[model samples]
Target: MAELLVAGGGIGGLAVALAAAGRGYRVTVLERRDAFTELGAGIQLAPNAFRALDRLGVGEQVRERAVFIDELRLMDGTTDEVINTMSLGTAYRERFGNPYAVVHRTDLYQPLLDACRRTPGVELCTGAAVTGYEQDADRVTAVLANGERVGGDALVGADGIHSAVRAQMIRDGEPLVSGHTIYRSVIPMDRVPEHLRSNAVTLWAGPGWHFVHYPISGGREFNLAVTKDDGAREAVTGRPTPADHVLAQFPEIGPKAGLLLRLGEQWKSWVLCDRDPVPGWTDGRVVLTGDAAHPMLQYAAQGACMALEGAVHLGSVLDCDAGDLPQRLIDHNYALAPRTARAQQVARAMGREVYHPAGVAAKERNAEIGSLSQAELHGKVAWLHHGTP
Candidate 1:
């Protein structure tokens, strides 16, 4: 069995471990933190994410904790008009092979971590941050922050956007600030106005800003994310912001959306960031996965989905003999670039053109989206939801 080393024990790292162990590869996952825990509020999981999780053996566990929303609605923030609605009913499920759902980030993380612990060939290591890697003809060694070295047949950098492994391999410097800052909150669903509490992932598009809210934590809570294109330079994460400050960012927000936004307390904010996709992320025995490989805007909501899909793809290719592994890694990187890069491009465009349009442009967007039938809506997202493998 090949000794595979995965840097970062987050969802992507644990997922790859689960996938590799199930395929008979001995895997060691090194996490920098003292405890392996996820810290995000909520995450959306498309059918494509479920397809990968089902392959990695954690789909049902996640589904049990998820809130399966019935529709995705787009609204004009200034006019309070429904721009479009895409039903995630039987038709969409039948087309995509799974339902669209949202969950607490922990709900997604814990299942992957539990399965990794239960698997025979997977080892989870804490307080072992991968600083960089050195590879020769036969083996690659990960240099840790504690001044120790761990040897393996190959290394997979599932380490997040600020990955040190990526720093050494790709040397791509820092991530690009999106000039868009998002404020997030989660409030009890029961507290939300009954009329506002719908089983839908709703997005409000305004001039230079947008808002998204959905049911999460098995419908017990609602997750709120509102973003503004304010040309922010520094990268910020989980920074606390007063409710008044957040309210001031979107002057043109509609009355209904304003009511829902006003109810959110304990707000936290993040200045969004991502990198332009590189042509390749493979170097012999060392490679990258997840956000380490491709980080993009949350506009598409496909960042984690792509990571899960990549883990499944990576595990599938590595199920063969180890002698030709380097070539396989090269092939893997090449094949994944086109799809991921397209996603990155699409996500950037959504943020600039669709979500943050002005009066005339916003009306045009609404007119165009309103023209699409449910089947047309399904057709547009089929390429994303029904993925290869």
Candidate 2:
């Protein structure tokens, strides 16, 4: 079996470790942080992601801590009317084979960690920062920030948007920060008004601004995300404005949205960024996954799901092969590129629709969406909501 090293302990890297360990490969995860903690946010895991977690035997634990939403509700910003809705609750389960769920970022990480701790071939090392790597014909070695070295048969960069290993691969390409910024925060369920806390993902779309909110942590809290177009900020800019400044931008979000922002305990800004699809995700013994490979805006709500799918597919390819290590890695990337590209395109389009809808065009678009037949709505998201193994 191959010895694998995964840099970064985010969802993608941990999934890779789980996939590798299941196949009896020796896997080590090196995380730079001293303790495992996720930033403020919630992620939606569709059926595909649930199937992937099921492969690791942690699906039940995840479900116990997450909120299972049945539908996605699109609303009119001015009228506060439900424009359109998709049945992700029962309909999705019938179409796909699993349920969609929402959870705090930490809830998603904990069960994966527990499973990794129990697996014999899996090891997790914290506070270990990977600085660079050296690859030869037969093996790869990761150099730690403190002058330590770890050797393995191959390396996977699940290190996220600021990947050091991805940097080494491109040598010439860098991520372009789309001139947009997202503000995020979460609040306790008690803080949210009773009318807004339901098993639906509510989205408010308006010109140059949009808001997303959903119940998470088994209905104990609500996750909130706001995105707006920011005119050209200088590269390497300073910190974003405080939560109050963010609240000031959304005076039209109505009572529920306003209440959520007023009650959120912490808030932060993230510069939205993405890159053109790379021709390949592997070179020799190193490969890339997740945001490191294809970062996209949250409008699609598939970031974690796509990463989960990639990990499962990568593991399945490797698990079925006993020889030709490099070719197997190449095949993994080949299978993933098309899928990631399509998802990226959809994400970009969704971002434009939500934040850059032209003039009064947003109203017309919302009307069209509300008038869509079930077949039409399902057709638009079939690729994402019902992915096959």
Candidate 3:
């Protein structure tokens, strides 16, 4: 069997390993952490994500832990008016071949980790950070933080936006700080007033800011993610903030939305960041995947989905028996580049055009989105949710 080394054991890395193992390659995943675990609060999984998860054999497990949402709502934060909403009902499932759902990061991650553990010839290593990589014409090797070297037929850099493997391969400086600060709070459902709790994913868009809330953790917890275009010059991640400070940032939102924001405690903030998509990520027998290859803003809610897609696509195109690893890796990057770039662009656009417009711009955004008929709304998302991109 062929050997593959995957750096980073987050959602993407684990998926890549499972996908390759299914394709008859022996995969070893090198995770830097002390144990195989997932952090973060919640993630929205579109139908495209399910398609990729199903391909990796964990779709059902994820579904068991996910909250199948009723709809996605965009609202005028200041006026308390509904802008647009997309229904994710039976029609949507039938149209897209999958349900739209939200899951705690662990809900999705655990299933992938479990699948990796169950698969034969798949090894999961913790605390084995891949520092860099070296490749000859015949094979590639992962240089570990501990100074140990592991050789494999090919290498995948799924180590996230700050990937060490990517540093060696692409030499792109650092991830682009999006200049937007996002505050997040995950509170138990019981703490939330019944009026604020909902089965739908709702976003209240204000001037240069937005607030999104949804049920996650199988309805046991509510996830709150609110962003501010505060011109934060440096990149920050998961830094705790005073709840009062967080609430003060979005004064334009109506009282009702303001009340909802106030329910959040233990708030943490992250300065959103992503990278400009490059034409290629392949370096001989080594290549980049997930955030290492293409990281995008969370506005599209497709970051995890794109990572899943890339891993599955790579696995499908890599033939162990062909003895053509380099070209196959290059082709994998090429095939996914256009779609990934488009998604990145869409996410960036959504932040500026849809989520943070103000004054007349906000009014026009409301009128335009509110004017969209349900069919028109579904038609607009069909390209993305239909799973091609």
Each model's total of backbone clashes:
0, 1, 0
Which residue segments of model 2 deviate by more than 4 Å? 232-241, 254-256, 320-323
Q: For candidate 2, lDDT tens digit of each residue in 1-389?
A: 67999999888888989998888789999899997656657898888888888887888999989888888888765457777988875666887788878999899989988888888898899988887789888899998888999999889998887788888886645677777777777778887777656898888776677778898888888888877777545333224468778887777766655665566656777777777777698988888999988877677888888888888887877674434667888989988888888888888888787545756788778877888976788778778877644
| Candidate 3 backbone overlaps, count | 0
lDDT of each: 0.92, 0.80, 0.92
Clashes of 1: 0
Local accuracy of candidate 1 as per-residue lDDT tens digits, 55-153: 988999999999998999999988889999999999999999999999999999999988888888999999999999999888899999999999988
TM-score of each: 0.99, 0.94, 0.98
lDDT of 1: 0.92
Instruction: Estimate, for each residue in 227-275, the C-alpha lDDT of model 3 and write its tens digit.
Output: 9999998999899999999988987889878888999999999999999
RMSD of 2: 2.2
Which model scores highest in TM-score? 1
- Residue pairs clashing in model 3 are none
